[model samples]
Target: MDWTTVEKNWAAYTPRVLTRWPGLDEDEVLATDGDLDRFAEYLAIATSQSVQGARDEARGWAEGEEPADAKMDPTRDNERIFDSAKNIPVGEDVYSADADFGDDRIPEPPMDRKAG
Candidate 1:
């Protein structure tokens, strides 16, 4: 993985780093400020691994990392206007006077009263 890329996008990767090494605190991780060597040092202390081992693990994590935007749920942005639209009645009830055939506009009220 490119350490430079990770450094350039540090804020996006911080959460993943914390997940990979929950023993480390957010303040401590943020303090590294995208320095690979400093991050490796923190990882080593938190995981009880050697600096080299921590570096290797960090590299592996970086390799597996995807952009945060790509991880968003597809359904999260969906706008459902009507939840009960899916439960339409069939057979005899299908031809009701109140059956809505996709026309959602509200009709204007009649101007029965005369202006003064």
Candidate 2:
């Protein structure tokens, strides 16, 4: 596949991917060519297919075509790594420490029902 086709596929498929995984915002998704390339890389790995094959499969998905046979069982390690990946935020500060807004805070731990 040519660079133009790769780029075009990236642009078209990105929004569909984001919609499926709504935890990520489009702005926080494929913002650059490198990011788009990485997206394709992961997709290919997950499907156990070549980059071009994965791109073609995903293009069908983006076009509202019947689902192609791009899916395969990812390895356990790969699944864990994919789950662990943090969403890349755009134009926003990502504080290492999480903060909860003030006012209503739970001070005591709830009793475990399983203990009964």
Candidate 3:
């Protein structure tokens, strides 16, 4: 499949995925050129060339022939964008601490070992 089609599909599916797990973001879920290229390469290797035209061209390279397509630099949006988690300070009030000692204390030790 073309990268645009794959990305469009991902965009459509992003909401459902987010509904299932709110932690994930749309950008991260969308496919990147790198991801598409890898997938296409794998498809070319694993499946018959006739099955998918996209694989037909890459099948040779997948089978060890040199790649025909020149590798391109990643786009600005190629990588997923994410906001780092905010650092929240924890206060002592959140956790209470208490220590108690018995009325009886340890006796003094002998000053000299030889005395024993």
Name the top lDDT candidate: 1
Q: Report clash pairs, candidate 3.
A: none
Compared with the true structure, all predictions reach lDDT values of: 0.74, 0.50, 0.39
Better of 2 and 3 by TM-score: 2
Off by over 4 Å in 3: 1-8, 31-116
Q: Rank the candidates by lDDT, best first.
A: 1, 2, 3
lDDT of 3 at 114: 42
* TM-scores for the candidates: 0.57, 0.28, 0.21
lDDT of 3 by residue, 14-116 (tens): 4543454355445654543335555444444444443356444433323332122222213323332221112223442323332222234545557765423
lDDT of 2 by residue, 1-116 (tens): 23444354454545557666455456545764424456556667655789888666555545453122222223235744665556534533444333333334545446664422
Q: How accurate locally is residue 111 in candidate 2, as Cα lDDT from 0 to 100?
A: 68
Residue-pair clashes, model 2: 0
Poorest stretch of ten by lDDT in candidate 3: 64-73
> Each model's RMSD to truth, in Å?
12.8, 15.4, 19.3
> Candidate 1 lDDT, tens digit per residue, 49-90?
999999988888888856754334244234232444457655
Candidate 2: Cα lDDT at 30: 71
Residue 29's C-alpha lDDT in candidate 2? 51
